[model samples]
Target: MLSPDKVSAHADEDWENAGAGDTIDVERLVAVVRRQWRIVAVCMGIFAILGLVYILTAVPKYTASTSVLIDRGNSQIANQMQASVAAALPIEDDASVLSEVELFKSDSIGLAVVDKLKLLDIPEFTSPARSPISMLRSLLNFRTWFASDDVAADDIDTLRHNAADKIVADMDVDRIGRSYALSISYTSTSPELASKIATSIAEAYLVDKLNSKYDATRRASEWLQERIDELKQKALDSDLAVQKFRTAHGLLSTGGQYQLLSDQQLSELTTQLIGAQADTARARAKYERVKSIIDNKRTDAIVTDVLDNSISNDLRKKYLEASKLEAEISARLGPDHVQAVRLRSEMAEYQRLMFEELNRIAESYQSELQVAQTREKSLQDSVTQASSVTAAAGETQVQLRELERTADTYRNLYQTFLARFQEATQQQSFPITDARIITRAQVPTAPSAPKKPLILALAMALGAAFGGAIGAFREYRDRFFRTGEQVRDVLSLEYIGHVPAIDAKEAGSGNKDPESVRGLQNGNGITNYVVNHPLSAFAETMRSAKIAVDMENTSTRCKVIGVISCLPGEGKSTIAVNLAQLLAMQGSRTLLIDADLRNPGATRAIGRHAEQGILEVLLEGRPLKDVLLLDNKTKLAFLPAVVKRRVPHSSDLLSSSIMVNMLDELKAHFDYIVLDLPPLGPVVDARAISPMLDASLAVIEWGRTSRRVVRTTFAVQPEVMQKCIGVVLNKVDTEKLKLYRSYGSGEYYYNRYSAYYHEA
Candidate 1:
């Protein structure tokens, strides 16, 4: 029976392979780009050549510009002309200048330029211009040159319209700030034609302006002349009516104004009535004073004028003397004496005479006052009658004044129309415009298009971008492990080491050696590189892989390491042979078994006959040491297998109870046993004997093996994968390892230590 201790320990060392679960691996992607950078460089070079060809063959084009300055100098004409003429012209505002810009690009202006310069004959305006691409097309196809030329008369108009459109499209008019100036630029194949068209457009605009102003003034003159004649006739008829009305009313002017006859009589009577009223008042006052004195018997109290008469004054004096005499007589005689009586009689006679004189004076004053009052009343009645007659005549005077005002109004209107007619006639003879050309157009000297530097710069940038994108896409689609990290990340297995490719020189081949079927051939028949090149880095890396396998085993008994690969040519047997040699060189007893009955690579390398290998011991039930070959230099033993005699398949012999018992018996003699199994990718031999092994290691060809094939190896035969301990990335290219060093840790380590090993 197989040793239970070794069998159970090997079972425990088995681990899941990468394909046991899915995961994303990016390190392998970066390795693909680094490995295929040459392809990307080639693609970019091709694009650069194409760009150069296009730029060199492109046709050269020219453009020309001309400027015209619009100065509103004609605005000064408004100030020089009459006010009415100035009011009729358009004023220059911001809107007017912008309107002129639109007019400069107008179809009318474009058509005028086309007609003046006969631009329809130019091929660029009438049809599409010939470019480099179009010229190439015409050369390739003869049908393009024989295109139809027949068209209707309407097509000629259409052609002219199209030419006008092209002229307008190629021309640019720009206003200079807020000023009335323009920069007119035109693009064409000929510089002279562009400048000539620009100049003609400006001249056309000036002529159109002058004609517009002249027509407006002529229309105004004709309308005014008709209106003036009508106004003159109306004025004359109004003056004749005013004179006729004045004669019919029989009015006259006393001052500078006309007056009625009744109004004159009323004026004279008013003056006489005022004088008679004053005389009547004075007479009545004198009569009242005198009459009052006579009625009261106060003859002495009468006014001086009433008593100024001599007879009244003497009577008053005589009465005073008689009173004195009568008093003296009465004192001498008795109170009834005849002398006193006779004196009193004389005084009475004098008093009666004075009273009569005062009465006469009062009567004269009363009669004169009554006569003055009657005359004043009669004059007042006459004045009132004359004033009523004058009021009636005032109505006719108002009508006469209205007729005179109408005549004056008609005369003033006739004079104003006559003045306007004269001004309109003057405007017709000398018309003015609101805009004038300050500067004429001139030919330009340079083209303004097809910037070559910018085009080439963009072309080179695009080419590089396209090449990079293609490289990235190739990287994404690659399905292989190119770095040592892919062993761990993509395959989901532990990484043992990176083993550089061992060439014939490094393997130390000699003339006396036997040739091998497939391996690094060296003298002495496929010499173990680890043992021959002892101080080399490749030998050192094999030693490291031996240590890692040894660490995983950790058993005092025989440690069985099964070496396998996903594909047949991935160098698994070489790694196993070298690893066993390294372990034996360390003074440990090592056994290298060639268990691949189908393809015995190690059996052939050791120059041992295949019939005397493990199949003899297992099938014939022979002794354990009967088929073993020992090497003296490394102290390693090898049991090589021969495929000359075949059974049903390799798995039948590998999985048999005899094979297990054979491995168990050898465990007591060897410290480690390395099994070189057939590739797991193409056969089931590796999985069949997995349970009998301590641990398994995978060997991959760097940058050459497919990741999908390796994954399928573990996925289909999971039992073999469970016994796998780790992986070894073999046959690495050191220069490429340095380039893709950043892709994985194993590549970086290999690049750093590659110099330690010298190549012949």
Candidate 2:
């Protein structure tokens, strides 16, 4: 039984505060003891024997560990930015340590270590003294995996990988519960060897990291130097290209820069002057046309065309007027006359004026053209000055370009040189990494396995568990009982009494060779409750319960307590007789009634003569007093159930109130009565006989009555199922009780029973 206090204490010890879990898996050592006791026993036994074996014949290994602190001296190192310090130390980042870890696991590092130790060429370990288990392990080793092939590149790679893998495998690095420190440990049959291996691994890691940094920096310096040289050459070539371009172009000193600028200015002025001269000529022509338009209201088309053509517009106008006068004279005076002479003179004068005017205009036009040519000459001079200035400007531009090319070349070369120098100097310094050893493996004096105390304790507990398992299995699987409680619990009936399941030697009152009713038990008779303690509670309880039941109903009659079962051969007949005898011994007028009409058992078991009985009296309509059979020795009366092949509807006969009335009549004569009925499961005879009984009881064979079949048997009779008060479990083995007490059985209170139950 699990008590609240014990369970709570256990739960608290386990710190089980989780709200009741989805499923309670309380494997309280108790339940385990009750359930898997065998498994626990076996496991404990194995461990114990293993301990003993370890103590006796097993080799004891002593561990010797020495500690080391991988103090990556973080605080001791100087920071680069703090120039106030004497020396600026390189700060090592976490990445550096991780890198070292990876590199330490590299094949190059591992192979170097292996070569130094000469482990690579060590032939396969083929020792004759190897254990079978060890031999099996070696058989699956790498050498065997590739033993048949020639060494190849892939093989070499695998070898290197495995070598590195072995280093990690052999060395146990513990930073498990620690920080920034590695405690490396190695175990070997030789303590010194383990220490050496651990030390070597650590030293190898630091050295490898340092070498890698130095190599990387050295390579960078070499690359930078090469780049500097290449850049210098490129700068020189670019400078030469610019110089050649200048020489071919005839560009002199930068004085020509101004000359080219001056030429550009002159070209601009000349273009402007030419435009102005052309505009002046166009304006003069337009002015003459406007004057002509002013002088004459209408101007002829031919006059307009010839206005600026080496002739003045005024001359053309006078000539036109004279021509008009001559036409008038010719029209008025006929051929010759004095007036014609005067007009000719005037015409001559006009012609002369017109010629003079034409000459003047031609002169003026020529002058203007001459002036434009002069101005163009002046612009050419200005262009010449501008060309000089442009030359100076071009030369200055060339010099500026040359200077820029030189500066670019120098800067590029200087940058490459600086990079190379920095790399070389930094490489020369070879700054030590910031990482250092923190915690190292500690040497232990004892091994952690094969504890002896734990072994012995486990062994004792194992034995008890083994015994309990055997007992529990037997308790669940076995069938039958030989005690009163065993009978009452299964049948749910008040136990009349227990008549122990006896061996053939002490057997009495049962079938096989029970030849007589008088003094049936053999010599030195059976040591049964019947003979040993007649006044025991086992018998008294039966009498008391029967009395209580009868008194409650207040019916004093020969009502029968039917002793029935689901099937045959369950000691029911024997119980019926014993019960009647027990009642008789208690001075109750008891009658043992046998109602198994089809097959009579009482006539043989009791060895009583059954020449006249209940069957004969009932069917023949005879008086039942003549049918009463008395046990010759005990004061118990008996009613025999006759064996007859021709026994009519015996089930109906048993149920008829005629039978109830018959018992009612006999109740006046008898104090107690019992009926041994046929097995009620297969027949309805018991149900038919229910009215004839005041009370009833049934017996169950303990473990053999499976849950399924028990229900099957219980369903056989309605009255038997409904009226059954208690069950009787039979044939329990007592040996299991002792083991149970040691294993799963707890301390019980004896005071509860000590007052009432006296040991006999």
Candidate 3:
């Protein structure tokens, strides 16, 4: 049994064991989970209820959609072009049709829509608002939502313009994919209105397209008419210029051959004059030179001397031949040999031939000069005749060129006027267009705002997160260690035994019911296998541990042991009583002592009074038989604490020489003497008395008295701990025991000990 002081000491130790922060207690966690299941239920239920409410109240929407196949309308356009154009175009790729399609999307087409629909009143096409809506919004607090309220229009045109701009927003035009087609869709509060607008826009666009084609055709016709007129005038003017020049110059009949004949005659005459002049000059020079020679009147005489000297000429030849021969000999043979000398002699003969030829040519020049005089007179006469013919041809060419230029001018003017007349005749045949409606737009039946499901789901998720936060905060603040497993795992201790809970009625094993603490086989004993099946497992486990501990030393077989606990009512005294009787039943003599001097809950545990027990023997020095209480059923003996001193000084008496002798005597008489000591915490009694024992077991209430008290029970002095065998955790809940699965046969443990109550 644990003294009050010991229980207090153990509690302090257990608290200190829990570090910076205590860890989660599984027993407490189980209790919390049991208590807070309703909280979790409420949170989940709230989320579900909110989801249902959102589903019930939210507005439902339907999407309205339609599709159209775009039509490029190019084939029809090409056919129209082929029918309308007269001249063959040199174009490889014509852009007129594509340009027309672009024109349909232009502001010109938009204006065409305005014209057709008479939408000049719409704001988009009308005059600027001039601080109208903006000024109103700034003035009124409600302006953002009611911005258009105070806008003032100056005239019907402004009103129509604003309306037109607003209506334009009700229509859409999209170029569909890569094709030349366009898709247009309109949305409106009224289905019919949207359909009307879409269909109207399409009709208006087609009208604009037709107008584009018509306008292009009209412009083409007008331009071609003007060009044809200009070309006709140019042709007429060219003809008139040719005719007028002929009239002015009077040689309009000169054909193309006349100019060629005159040019040829002029070229021949010019050549003849040049030759005549050259001949005359040559004759005059010859006559003058001959006369000078005949008269010897020329006095610059170097030429005359050379002409008259024959000897000098012969010397020149001989020297020339000698030089030539020397060159020949050097090239062909030796320079100073006999063949070279003979060749020099032959060259001397030919040297005279030069003077002979010169004399002959001078004689011939005199005869030729007389013949040239006669020819010069004849050539001069021919040149004069040719000059007269060339003059006549020049006059004729000038007249014919003037006539041709006049005729060209007249012809160009005439042609220009005639072509203009011809082009005007072609304009009335061009084409135009008639516009009609195609597809209509439809109104949307659903709003484009507020998708309910997505929004509500987000809210529910947020609510659940908040709810879980509330649950987690409450779990962090609790403070006790609630399980034996916590002590085992957290403190790193061995588990020895689990004592079944002892009820208050069947608690006393010392005097009233000794049989209850007897053998493991009977139906009605304290630790019986039949009557108290749950306790039997605890007893069996204790027996096994006892054998293991005792086997380490043979002297342990007859050693006296003690049972201790963390607090009062933790089944320590009961465990001591049952254990001793069990050993006694096994034919080993056993004694059970209740040694708590301060508070003896152990006496109450055995249904005995704590009067004149240990205190009477120690203080008055009486015989041990005066206080010993013996039960015969299981052959167990008991001693109760007689002193109920608020401050008991029993440490000296228990650890004294007399107590030591008494313990030795008991050890000799019994195989196991069980002492139920005062708790080690409140006083020094248990520590002082520890050296008199072989081993001790600490008892702890399973789900009560926390880890603090249990550890303090074990953390006594080394003298006390030397006798500390292990521990016993008492009063486990059977149904909840299944949570610890390592106790594979825990149900049997619970069932076996639980039968004791039924049997009683």
Candidate 4:
């Protein structure tokens, strides 16, 4: 058995252990779900019903689908040819395909389909069902109130526009993978109408493409024709200007070859002058050679022109023969031979004849030289004249070249535009679109909306999620005592036991004896329950409280125990009365006192008919024996508080010297004294009388009282908390308590030990 100090130290150690850390407890979560399972079921059932209602009320719609392939292959030839003559069209890509998909959903296509299909005449388009917001506005008559009387309702144009908008709203368009294919789908109540609308939208898109291309080509052709005419006139004007400028500047070109006449004349004059200069140089050389041979009278010098003269060649041959004979005669004969003299005279005569012939040739060379010089001078004069005329023509050639280049550019442009004009004309006549129908829209066989099972499943899942959230909130706020573990962990006090609530009806139904029957009829069943059901859990809990009191005050002669609570209606008076009865039944002299002067619940339960009680004993000096009521079965004495009027100063009365002396005097007659005190939360009467108590028992309502309130109550009343031996969880519902059971707790094994208690 532990003393109060040792018990307190042990509680402190347990508190430290409990406060070490907070972690998730799976058992606690299971317990919470068990306690709130009904709420979850109710929420799930409501959501399921709503889902079913929606499914039953929803209108089913049929969907029709059509596929359009963007056939770039069909336009490849035209695009390639057009690219050579103009800016190339952009190549088809993912972005271009997606753009085509968007075009299928555009307002232009939608409006075209609406008009072509005469959708405004159909009931689904013209007189469609009103939306919830529109219905609400109609109910309020807001349009009539805000609009002018002159405003027309549902005009033809407005109806057509609305039909177009409705068509667009019901349509879905998307690209199919990376390929150049578009999928268009539409939904409506009628399968045939859905198919018709989808097909009409696709047809409208393709037709719109063809019409756009045709219009663009026609415009391009008209512009190209205008440009061709303008370029043709400009090319003709440039050609005429070039011809007129050339003729005015005397820069006429040679026929067939476009060379200027002045340049040809200069070229011919330069060639002839070169020939004349060569002839003059030859004639002058011949004349100089003949003159040198005649002036020096030398016969050794040779000239080609003189050599070609036959008379000069013969004379030179004869002179050579004679000189040879003269040399031989002079060598054979002495001083002056007649033959040598004769041969030398003959060589002289031959030299004279050759000189005469050379003179004649020189005269002819001089005449030829004069003629050649005259011809060279005449050609030089002609070349100088041609050079001056060519130089003048060269100066004027810059402007002529400019005019000629301008003419050539205009001519090329004219030809290019002429080709472009022809291509555009061809395109306008035979227009082609890039898109074609791959799969025509077909009527759907079945409705495509309002999946009942999926909706119901989703609704149930949402409901479960919502219910779980609420359950989590309830668990977060459930900070109250439920088991002995909570008492030990939260308040750090030994948990005595649970005092199960005994109803008046149940108490009377079990009892057959007159005394037990009388106690049940008077609402004193709970106070006398320990005596009637001695082997029951209620009686067993009272025995446990007694044991805790004994252990805490082992050395004390008189144990004055106070039964207190944090808040009102916690059944402290019942615990006090039952504990005292249990002590007296075990052959101990026990005295139960109703110490709460303001609300004497113990006196009302066991001593309600008493005339005077603790007030008389404390204020009027009445003897305790005179006001005490005796229980015949248990031999227990009770002191009840019979308040005739409101007692404002309840705490002052409990802490008074008269009350202390009265307790001290009663201690000599009683082995154990149990006081039913007011709650510590609202009043300080329990704390005021705490110093006189040997041990105190805190009575807390199971799962109803908050741990924070109880802790605050003890914190404010430190003396009461120090004297408190343990805590008792009162009014426990055994069935509900099972949900809060945890491992190692007293209630966890209650089912196994429940057979030991006999209530009937």
The candidate maximizing TM-score is 4
Tens digits of per-residue lDDT, candidate 4, 1-760, equal 2356756777776775567447677777788889888778878888899889999998999999999987876687566655534432544677777677778767789889988988877988887478998777677986567776663655767887888889889999987877777899999989999999999999999899988888888899889989999999999999999888877766644665455777888889999999999999999998998898899988899888777888888998899999988898899894289999998899989988988888888899999999999999999999999989878877577777788899999999999998888788777655667778999999999987777889999988888877888877887898999888788767777788898877877765322234431221225477778888899999998999999888778898889999999999999988888899899999999998999999899888877667888888878999877888887667788888999988888889889999888888988988999999999988888888888999999999998999998987788888888888788899999998999997667788999999999887
RMSD of every prediction: 17.8, 17.4, 19.3, 11.2
Runs with alpha carbons beyond 4 Å of true place in candidate 2: 1-46, 62-115, 119-170, 176-179, 211-431, 437-528, 564-574, 593-630, 637-671, 677-691, 700-717, 729-760
Q: What value does the lDDT take at residue 635 in candidate 2?
A: 67
Between prediction 1 and prediction 4, the one with superior TM-score is 4
TM-score of 4: 0.71
lDDT score, residue 243, model 1? 74
**Candidate 1 worst ten-residue window by lDDT:** 513-522
Higher-ranked by lDDT: 1 or 4: 4
RMSD of 2: 17.4
Q: At residue 432, what lDDT does model 1 achieve?
A: 64
Clashing pairs in 4: none
The lowest-lDDT stretch of 10 consecutive residues in candidate 4 is: 512-521
Please, what is the TM-score per model?
A: 0.53, 0.52, 0.42, 0.71
> Which window of ten consecutive residues has the lowest lDDT sum in model 2?
741-750
